[model samples]
Target: MNKSIVAGMLALALAGCASQQPEQPFTLTVAHINDTHSHFDATDARLELGNQALFTRLGGHPRLQSHAESLRRQAEAADQPLLFVHGGDAWQGTGYFKLNQGAMNADILSRMRLDAMALGNHEFDLDNERLAAFIGGVDFPVLAANLDASRDPHLSGLENLRPYVLYEFDGHDKERLESMDDAGDDPVVAVIGLVLEDMAEISPNLGELIFEREVLAAQRTVRALREQEVKHIVAITHLGLERDQRLAKEVNGIDLIVGGHSHSLLGNFSNLGWDQNEPYAQVFTNQDGRGKTCVVQAGQYAQAMGRVSVTFTPDGRVSQCDGGNTLLSDHAFFRDIRRAEQHRLAGQDAARVAAFIEAQPNIALVEEDPALRAHIDEQYKPALDRAYGEVIGHVPVELKHVRLPGADGQGSRVAPLVAASQLYWANTPAVQAVTGRRADFALVGAGGVRNSLEPGELKEGHVSLELLPFANAMSIVSLTGRQVAGLLLEAINGTLPEGAHTGKFPYSAGLRYEFSETSKGRGYLSRIEHLADGRWQKLDPQAGYQVVMTSYNASGNDGWNTLYTAQQVLTDRLDLAFVDGRLTAFPVARLSKASGGGTQVHYINQPLECNAEGVRCNTDAQAFIDYVRDQRPVLTELTPATVTLNRL
Candidate 1:
């Protein structure tokens, strides 16, 4: 009520705002989401805090929309420029993807009103035609500067894709980006798209497309943009954090890098030894050593959004940067779990628990947007509801699967579940119909599996969580016992790209081998055995056998390339053939169905076109669902008879 006090308070607030401003600065706010992976609805997310793992609800499209809207409002109130960008991989994780291959995500993301998105590796999971179609339906620009579309007829026109986009904004809304309160001449900002170079190795869908080296492609694009008088360049990149950092240090002209693909969590920079929790924005000196380039990647699954506030000089050079992740730690549900843990730790004390719960930090969670929630209820819930209840099988015990590093990030111990399932499908009569015999063993790459089945009841929905993210068809391949040994050698000890990990470590079923982490190259193998008549027998190199595996590995993704190319394995290799349960070989059908007609196709390549009628091929998920349904309760445990023994 005191005028003098009110005036002083107003003056102090203005001073605070001005203190954050740099001379000749153009303050811009960026709201970014990445690797959403179809978590269109809220899900329980786990967090590892110091010594305790906590559960919290994270990510629903509505909540993400609400958060972004709030950012837009905040930026508008501050009279600063704001941009909403998605870092891609909006498909694959949820039942929404399994329903119609991510069509709903496209509609939902468009409704969120995103300006642009980088091309993520998982986008290629749908194959070229489907991906092209998905892009055609999206309202925003899909970016990837390094992807050469000449190989695919559908992608040759470069429709729905841009190497880069230039956008101008002001109060006048000349470019229609949005409004700035105080009208002025529109300032142009350039956004370039960069893809990971090893995309082809990761997804068979990209096998035909050529990718440019990230740094070189960026350098060339930055020069071209600079020539056009575009300043303040931001690269929307699918390159994981490491490559993005290298791109920043190796190339010049880029002002900022918004990245995805690694699902990295950036917060604390000092703990470089751990994978997550790096500083939100890493500052790197451009190659010119004149200006700084700031790189940021929001952690995956739409669980968090990265907010970046940048102050740029009038000359279009970055002057200062600040921001961090806004995690949606909903206390509504997870608090109950916390209470249980608390009560267990301290003997049952209702009053104490109540007091403790009340004493907890009142961190508010973002509310889901009503409109988006309504849209999901109307358009998505029906299918999702059915999927959630559809039974797949029963598990005798929990099959734990997490990306926890074993052998110091070499691989995960949980990979065996994926391998065992692959072997199960391979031994099926459908597989026998093709190879004229049942598969003797199976192998799968560690990274291909997204999650492990928990103990108890399994459903079609659970399958989506465990294995659907890949969209990789199941398949069988015939190889001599010698080739199997050679493949194992190549996987563990071969010369992988610098910084590439053995996360694609092989997990074999019906075969056991002992290897030490200390071994290198061919020396990695110590002892190996095969299950013959449920008996462990020494692997005979001369014998022939059928193997089941993900189509991803069969097509030579990760380190599988070494196994077949004679680079790190035995000299001879074999050809792949297409087979079905009907004892028929549809070579042409398989070509069009899986690997897009590649030289080597996997046995379980699914959603295929089998007959002239154009029937949809069975997907790997379907095969798994069917296999599990028949078995009812599959026991999960490691016994002395378990395959793939690691000394580690």
Candidate 2:
């Protein structure tokens, strides 16, 4: 044995060990908001503070900006890398968007210093040209890995509309690392965008664009980034909280998901009178049963912002994750926001409420960002104020809107009213003249009605611009009782599954049904009835009836494909007719040969005049406004519950 040979071999092994040092762990801070929906002004929310029900204003864009900027400053002082992002649905909820459209959204969000945002379904509420204009105006990149805009002339050339983006952080300063030259080695984290795959079914204006499957897109993008040596991956998604969890379970290498669309308030808000018990930063094991992914979502309408701190191992697995939604609120407290002047809290009550908010880790009383607030007040708000100022009617009590029926079988208190309005408007002489038939019933999905009807003066702005903000035209569809029953069953079944989207839950006027989740009977629908001559009777499967709904529903969006198919069949033999100096089209269901080979057509479900008239022809909103105006002291009862859940 040679001593010199042994020593040289030992030195070589030591050198190899020195070169294989363990990679240092990285920690990233993230601030996120989702489903903002153009709610720039503070919205009223009731919280049980100090054992008293108090009304408080929750997060608006200004408050969100102020809190996010503060967080940015804090992270900078601590030398921690921070990324601010939105989970999408930043358009089309309030009067601001209704009046100013996506321009206002781009202006406000661009100032928030966002890193990236997912494309929400509402972003396609208008045409692709409008969406492209919005993307051009925003400073941050809009992402959608599943979206293929190559065929869209308006969106194909936008450089900032990308599938994913990479960010490199310097280890020493914790600042974003950028290359001075064209080539760079690798980035620290990759932010991937994922949206709903069936976006076309839900959003009608997505012209010449395509959406791929969400899970597949996410998997492919994550793999691509991993191959590029980018380990830490965060997916900003608009797939809702339930789908986000599913994505986390199915995808590998994803560390965290910031989500929207479900508008889930994920945190323990039981103390605040909210029954939200879902854990923030919810963790799920990857598809390969290795690594972990954390999910978080801020509630809808800019009511809260989620802040999460994630620590990644050397191999990019999520080691430790922590955070919750921060509900930004104002200092002023009231017993009832509708009557603030009469219900103001004072002295010990006010102090106790303030103390409670201060003690909560997820609640903060923050001042609005002065510049953004001033901009909103001066630039975009005046026109909205002036246009929506007229008082339409008054209500004595608030009508609540719940997307799904409760365990006790109680559904939304507001959506049924909206349905009744459509039925009322359809039966009017002006509307019936064009259709040549009266509407037997009306159906409205829960998602169509955005907000609860507050108890106070009902302004034109609240109904037309906020509650039913989509401005969808009213549509009448003629279908047999069998088809009507099938439509209800399809909608009910779509929402009955676990983690299903409850927005498809149907609320109706002049119609009622009993549904059982466990029943094998006709898609879980046990019984269905329609009101006729103030009497409720079983829906005859063969009887023909005219159903009124939004044009969005008639076109078969949002799990209502049956209606779309039925309308399409009738549309094949359509005819145009002039009634009262107005031109309208109707679906011709039957054609008979008259004398001399002339054909006579039978019309059904006349298409309302929506084009040219603009938002003025939004009969869905107009109907509700007219109903409230005609029926003084608006209806407050939720009785004759449209849906009954039979648990058997």
The Cα local distance difference test for each model comes to 0.66, 0.81
Writing each residue's lDDT as its tens digit, candidate 2 over 1-648 gives 699999999999876644332367778889999999999999888888767788889989999999999998888788788899999999988999989899999999999989999999899888789999999999988999998888878999798899987776653233333321222433367788988997866876665787899999999999887776567889999998889999999999899999999888899888788877689999999989997999999888998999999988766689999999989999888887674677888888778887888999888999999999999999988898897977877778878888888767767889988988888878878777767878899999888889887778889889889999887767776788998888888988888766677777788999988887784322467889999999999999999988888867766678886776675435432232334545354565643322311223345565434344331445677788878787644567557788786643
Give me the runs in candidate 2 sitting further than 4 Å from their true place.
1-22, 171-187, 519-523, 571-615
User: What is the TM-score of each predicted model, taking all chains together?
Assistant: 0.79, 0.90
Give the number of colliding residue pairs in candidate 2. Answer: 0
| Global CA lDDT computed for model 1 | 0.66
Q: How accurate locally is residue 427 in candidate 1, as Cα lDDT from 0 to 100?
A: 64
